[model samples]
Target: MSFATPLPGPDGDPLVVDCDSCVVRSPGACGDCVVSVLLGPPQDVVALDDAERSALGALADSGLVPPLRLMTLDDPPTHRDAS
Candidate 1:
């Protein structure tokens, strides 16, 4: 599956947040906020390619990483989820 490029996060470089309790963080969603945490400063959103997706998958599963897509996630549909 295609994802996005790995960028620094709004918080720190190599940003890695905890999403272990995320209800939607399972394969489709991801457990931790890795993507966002690692996401670099704000920039035009770019679609991820196959290679990028592989890299993201590996990066998101490390020690403590979560999909930080929320870091830069624009006003998309919202949902209430509990882990």
Candidate 2:
């Protein structure tokens, strides 16, 4: 099964998965991702590419933190269609 995309890091660079939070399994945040709550004080934020970052911030400032939802799949019943 597939999952959500991975988060980015400050400097727009991807961090190494040094710990458990580094993985892309979690939808919220991760240590490796640039913008996430996983990091403690002095941790970096997830800085997306220039254009994307601007849009992301604008959306947040516009009182639309999560304007819309991305792809979401409804897990099928077990022992059903695997074809």
Candidate 3:
């Protein structure tokens, strides 16, 4: 299966995923799945912006929405190696 295409955010920023370089590209749970956004550090908690919260609420209220799954990675892979 193919991965999900990243779309522009409300502010026109590109949401990107480099599936080709991802360590999880094969045999991982996210291999063929769509990811919404890349989050910040684990200790950081963020309140959703008004637009995001509204959109999420709308989607949740919609009957067409599917069950959601949340995944957290302790050490997420990066396309670039540290210098």
Residue pairs in steric clash, candidate 3?
A: none
After superposing candidate 1 on the true structure, give the runs of residues whose Cα lies further than 4 Å from its correct spot.
1-32, 68-83
**By the lDDT metric, which is better: model 1 or model 3?**
1
Residue 82's lDDT in candidate 2:
17
Q: Go through the candidates in order and give each one's C-alpha lDDT.
A: 0.40, 0.33, 0.32
Q: How well is each residue in 1-83 modelled by candidate 1, as lDDT tens digits?
A: 11233343332323333343333544545423444456543244444444555567666556344434443232223323222
TM-score of each: 0.34, 0.26, 0.25
What digit string (tens of lDDT, one per residue) describes model 2 on residues 26-67? 444332222332233223323236466555546544654432
Provide the lDDT at 78 for model 2. Answer: 31
Q: Model 3 segments beyond 4 Å from truth? A: 1-12, 27-32, 35-83
| C-alpha RMSD in Å of predicted model 3 compared with the true structure | 13.1
lDDT of 2: 0.33
Ranking 1 against 3 by TM-score, winner: 1
